[model samples]
Target: MSEATHTTEILIVGAGPSGLALAVDLARRGARTLVVDRAAALFPGSRGKGMQPRTLEVLDDLGVLDAVRAAGGPAPVGMVWSEGSRQGELRMFDVSEPTEAEPYQGLWLIPQWRTQQILLARLRELGGDVTFDRELTGLAQDADGVTASFATGPEVRARYAVAADGGRSTVRRLLGIGMTGETVDPSPTLVADVRVPALDRDNWHLFPPAGETGFMAICPLPGTEDFQLTANFPDPDTVVDLSPDGIRKAVTARSHLAPEDVTEVRWASDFRPRAALADRFREGRVFLAGDAAHVHSPAGGQGLNTSVQDAYNLGWKLGAVLRGDADEALLDTYEEERRPVAAAMLGLSTRVHRGEERRGRATQQLGLGYRDSALCVDTRDSIPPDALHAGDRAPDGHRGGVRLFDTFRGPHWTLLTVGTAPATDLPPLKNVRPAHIPPYEAYGTGVFLVRPDGYVGWAGETPTGLTDYAAAAGLA
Candidate 1:
């Protein structure tokens, strides 16, 4: 049972959305990464079909937003049916239009499989690839790096390892970390992808429950001929059958469609809705991400979005540290900033599952930030409470013949001066691009130092303490 040995800068333990997104980001930044998945291929299902606005922005930064849009569409209106009669349509989400600051205002419907395909394609385009059928059997880390042993292949040595292997993460278990949470719903749910020849693709079809039955929904997946069928079971102890015949029977019992209406069953699974957060996101050189760090119910569409964001937030920090532009201490901020966010989103998901909240602004995730983080340094005086501060997301707009997001794109930090030039001499910072713009209402008049992840790391009225801050952040 001897093992071959390999080495990489970063070893990602799963090839799902989180791992793929992180690989793409790191590859574009000239970091060497090895992504391995225990499964044989990419996921082939329509689960986690809702993509929030913030996630759309992340895709745009990763250079795959156009492809994602082409592969998917907006959420359709839900049509209600009772006793084989059409009832009034019900809106699944509050409608909101795009604005200058916030371009993506609503949820987009893209199958999780399609999203992973786009990310994988982008990763390969950036010179990265994922090795499938490589199951991690054990991992050990010391003061310098981590060594991961696989079940039947070579061992991998990496400076850092991330566990994106989902809720029952093997890496987390090997690290001896515990999760703290509760079951949001004990009832079982059946979700399946099927081809319904007689169903229309214009609207999401909903069927009200009959006596002693639960609600059912059949949503038409965008850009595909398949429909996603979801049915809730009333009994907590009931076993859900996932076979084709079993799914056909469930549809027949819950809706007006007969058993024969379901032409084919492509994929099916069952789960009890639950929410949980890891006790810690980091352990030595190992880190937890995506479902490995937090688990959410599918009600608010927060689980996948939050998972992708976890990768986005960690990617830049890892790139900076690995490229020698920032100190290793930058990695500590990943857990500090993202843990609270995951906690808040976990609560939001549970609330949405229980029907206590609406799918609106909070679901969009535009208001989430890290103003209280240690990396946020705001030296300006008399700032309004509602105004954008350090650690807030930088707004996108055009001013002085430059698009702010365009300037902020890529793997480098940005120094933006609005309505004022530097009052003092600026330091020579590595990988920090500087620009100037006229007074913009979104940013006001200040000197903003934006991080690679598009958050304001430091803000001041002038360049008085900019050099000192840069030195502290390892940019000098």
Candidate 2:
């Protein structure tokens, strides 16, 4: 047969959360992207179900927050049970109220499949879709671009390619990238979505380990009658059975529910907890993203959140470089900024898995930023140490009848002059949206330049160096 050929600006492997989120971001920026997956359909399991606050904000910018929120709900209180009696109530996440600066609070619970569906919908709305059953078998890159050959489809050529195909990433292995880390848990765990009509939807039912058995929990998934069941195996060599009868037996053996109560097994899978990070995020024009870049233990629910953050961080830089709006040097900051964050998150997830850390503010991921990156520039010398700095996430608030997030919603840079004014002859910056807000303490009365990804890129008491930074960074 003749070889079919296709070309695009960017080729994204694996239509998981990271790939889909990246495709959506680039789509809104008018970038050409092709997303491919080996699987014939979207992931069916509710594997990663927690959405951190920072991820919610990222989803808000992508125009899918409403749909996601509607499909999810706040994490329910954990109800502990002993035999057939109630033990106590456990708080799964540290709850906090929303503030003017941070509009999203607490942890939102949505099945991974639902989140992917929402992002896929948004991507299609932006005039892009994923190509399924395209298993990437070979990859080659040169000075110009990267070429990929699939098992059953056409040869694809793109200026850049990303690997978001989970921990067992084909592109990563093809690039010879090493994943260095250790097993967080030696014992295997089983995660499945099941339908149980006898279970109540008010609380997340939990059962403690008893004798040879292990701990088990069942959480009601919002917007559906299905419940996510997670069970641990204390023995390292224990084999998990994924069959419907096997799942029902496990549930009956652990909880007070009977085998007949488990009406249907929707989806099921098993794995041993591990935390690993890629040796590097990029090799030439081929980039590693999401679980392909970093794998985290599911204890603190950092895996999916960090993966989405990777996509959010890289999407804008790729779009800028592909559109000739920024220099290629900007791409280097992706690994520089995200690797350390990933390492930190991996450690946090391990600690949570080991019962050494609490899933509180750290797991929320709102405090993560690129403060030490080369792209950050802060000219103010006397500002308070606790105040927002140049590389921090821009706060959300309304001043002078202008909401900051509303101004920063699209795929464009934002220039906020907070209780400050530029000089009369200030140079004009291209593709930068301008907004004036009265002195908001969150920003500390300065001129802040926000990147397309919503992080403060440059801040100064005045716009003295704004134009120069913009021109040098290729944002002009």
Candidate 3:
């Protein structure tokens, strides 16, 4: 077979949740991207079963909340049981205040496969169709752009290439990035989807069967009469079995009931959680995002959520540099902002394994943000509670027909300036957006600037560093 020649404004390798989410983000911003996946079809197994509230906010921004809501992501009312002896009863739900900025206070538990389907559909609608069965064979990056080759297709020259592939990413290996974190044996658990005859569709149950191998968590699927359970079996050496007999035995053993109590088994799988992260998140025109960038124990179920956020963080930087809105320095912020987050998360995930540490019961929802970034100064004290970023997400309200984030637009020179300057007095930040904060003695409080992908940009009390801050934010 001969090689073909193709080019995209941006090239995204990996069709998993992160890559697809990023593709949609860029395509929505009018940046053309081509996503390549080695898989022939979307994986159907329920790999991950939850989406954090932060991720739900991202999906809402993409204008697909209704679809996600339809895809079995209802309000998160979950429970947990401890020790062992199987057969768990219902646990209490931790309720939180739901805001327009965060419509879903809890994780909308949905299978990973369904999440991908929703993202893929959105990508297609946005014109970022995935090229299936096309594996990235080789990659080479230069000062100007990166060149990516596929197994049986053409070479693609994109302004930048992002590797969102899984833990053992070929891109990471090809780029010679080292894995710095530890990888040890993780707690083994079994996950399955079923329809139990006697189980009702209300609360979650965790059975603490004896031997202390770990208990089983059983709960009714939010949208279906089918139920799901995560149980730790007695024999650590026993290979995870997905066969009907294996499923029956595992469920029966955990639920402490007869095998006949369960009928239809829709999904089954085994998982061992571990933590790992790439020593570097970027190398020239090639960058890493999602699982390719970091992998950690899913005890907190944060792998998918962090990966998606990584993509969101990188998407705008890439687009900015590509569209002449920002400079090369902007991309460096990816590693600076995200690597620390992954490290912090890895540490926190390790804590959950201790079983002795006590935390707020709402265990799965994560609140990872760069509020203390060196590049950002808290203008939160200056602003009232109604704003998006008192160093948080930029709030959007209706402006004419196109609901907008008031005076927020980005990819460069976000003049997060305060102190006496009228909106027009702000320096002309080419291709960047200017957000005006009515001056106060506290000054720019709760009014920090956010980069296009929503990380803290250059922040100061005096609305200072207008030019230097821009340079730090990838502006010329």
| Every model's TM-score | 0.98, 0.98, 0.82
**lDDT scores of the candidates, listed in order:** 0.91, 0.92, 0.68
- Rank candidates, TM-score, best first: 2, 1, 3
> Model 3: per-residue lDDT, tens digit, 1-476?
12456877888888888888899888877898988888898766566666777677667666566787887755333443343232344323344666433345655777777789989999889877988898888998777788888788788988888898888788999999998877434456788887786754556665666564456767666666667767775555668878777777876665556687778778887766677788999988888888898877655667788888888888877777777766677678789888988887676666654453322333433345665555555532454543333234543433223233334443333444444453354455655665555443333342355566544554444554455655545554
In terms of lDDT, the poorest run of 10 residues in model 2 is 421-430
Off by over 4 Å in 1: 1-3, 422-424
Score candidate 1 by lDDT. Answer: 0.91
The clash count for each model shown is 0, 0, 22
Q: Supply the global lDDT for candidate 2.
A: 0.92
For 9-81, candidate 1 gives per-residue lDDT tens digits of 9999998899999999999999989999999999899998999999998888889999999999998899999
